[model samples]
Target: MIQPQQQSFNQKIEVSNNFGIEVYVKREDVLHNEISGNKFRKLKYNLLEAQKLGFVKLLTFGGAYSNHIAAVAAAGKEFGFETIGVIRGDELVDKYLENPTLKKASENGMQFEFVTRTQYRDKNNATFLNQLEEKFGDFYLIPEGGTNDLAVKGCKEILTDNDKMFDFICCAVGTGGTISGIINSSYEHQKVLGFPALKGDFLFQDIQKYAENGQWNLVTDYHFGGYAKINDELKQFMKQFFKKYLITLDPVYTSKLFFGVINLISKGYFKPNSKILIIHTGGLQGLQSNIAEI
Candidate 1:
């Protein structure tokens, strides 16, 4: 909530007339430096609730290059709360300094506890959470992808009345929270499309939990391989995209989402003169780790 008054605007992307589609990007990345894009939306109310409950510390889970981890750390530093990140992959315990994201989080005063992948999977296990509470004393828990009722509530504000002009509302889905909020806030005529970064059948059920209506659909063909997986095609696309639009897309999420939307347009998925609005949920900080590839 550093710049709570900031509002994101939609900038139109130049699409070919042959495709019969109009693409616009919601520049949520400019909302803040650390808590950029959907991270700020997801954490807004959670942070307020934590403070209301008299908690001075916040705990969350993520991987080595997680945007959520970095954002949580930055929020903790800026908002005056102690922060802890339970990082996946215990091997990173000794080499975290080599990672830009982890190093930045550490600099922001986030304490880290590296756990193996198996242990990290138990993040929601009652006994595991109890153990963390026992060790950390007391802290407000934010989930791995920062998805929850409050998070969906905050995300609901991503769209405004002006956004209703678009026929399709699109965004990159992480844990389904952002899309759920969009689904709820969307006009009944608008089709909420989510391009997921991960591959799984569970996401449908996960999204169904918070979504109030059935106006949304997931486009799963564009994950590249899976979460955090990238190839030369994606890297080249990112480079060419930046060269053309001057918009830097994160390898993990936004890049794939944009790619999918463009591909769909080329395939005649959208009708003539369809206005598609895509959300830019920033994860650009992750470029530091994958810079060599791009």
Candidate 2:
């Protein structure tokens, strides 16, 4: 098994004194250029288990510009496992070359199985699994966003003894695996806040399945429309944020998370001298899809 490296220690983000909060980000995005951020964390143990179980191929599901898909493809290539991406949107199959994320995954040797949106929603259905098994032969399946028990186990490692000082832990929520791990590992006094990139409260239930404690809450106001949805205001904020922090936040996750944290700070929601640690879950590849817009 190839062990993943630990993330860098606190990289402080400068904030105004009026906010009375100290913000620091754990640089999980730089953990690896390809398999970076929570994607790496979620996949770390999944890959090990797959290899141990004697699985030769790994199959997963994702959208057109999913960082999970790209990370899996890169990890599979590096670790010697055949990878298959059950991508949503059948139209993407013919336009892979035009889509940077899909093109990169293909370059890394990930086979594509483009399914319609309706079919993609059945990704977790038993019938879907049976069909995939018959079509692709014996393979280990990792769910979309890689949020199984093993994936959450890997994500729990994102925080360490050094992070216990923070009063609040923040992360962007997608399928909820990453924040669930954070919630499980956070200090007793730490309140973990999740900013969902999608516009919905359903993630609260999804997270409940894995979180071991009640020290977490979902801040659903900063999705900027919905999943993979963005606007001019969000683009401008991202540009200003990058210019100030020298850190690039992908529109899909980290951007929304940062935006939420800052908004909360501005509203004095957090008490004075509060220490906040934000998890930078990487989805940088999603930026390529919006290059023309931003």
Which 10 successive residues of model 1 have the least lDDT summed?
285-294
lDDT of each: 0.90, 0.88
Task: Write down the worst ten-residue block by lDDT for model 2.
Answer: 285-294
lDDT of candidate model 2 versus the reference:
0.88
Which residues of candidate 2, in runs, are more than 4 Å off? 291-294
How would you encode candidate 1's per-residue C-alpha lDDT over 1-294 as one tens digit per residue? Answer: 345436788898896668567889999998888887999999999999999999999999999888999999999999999999999999999999999999999999999999999999999999999999999989999998899999999999999999989999999998999999999999988999999888886899999999998488999999988888999999999998999999999998999999999889888998888899999988799899872110
Give one digit per residue, the lDDT tens place, for model 2 in 1-294: 666555456799997768578999998888888887888889999999999999999999988788889999999998999999999899887788798988999999999999999998999899998999999999999998899999899999999999989999999988999999999999899999999988889999999999998599999899888877888888888999999999998877888889889888989999899999999977788888772110
The per-prediction CA RMSD against the true structure, in angstroms, equals 2.2, 2.2
Best by lDDT: 1
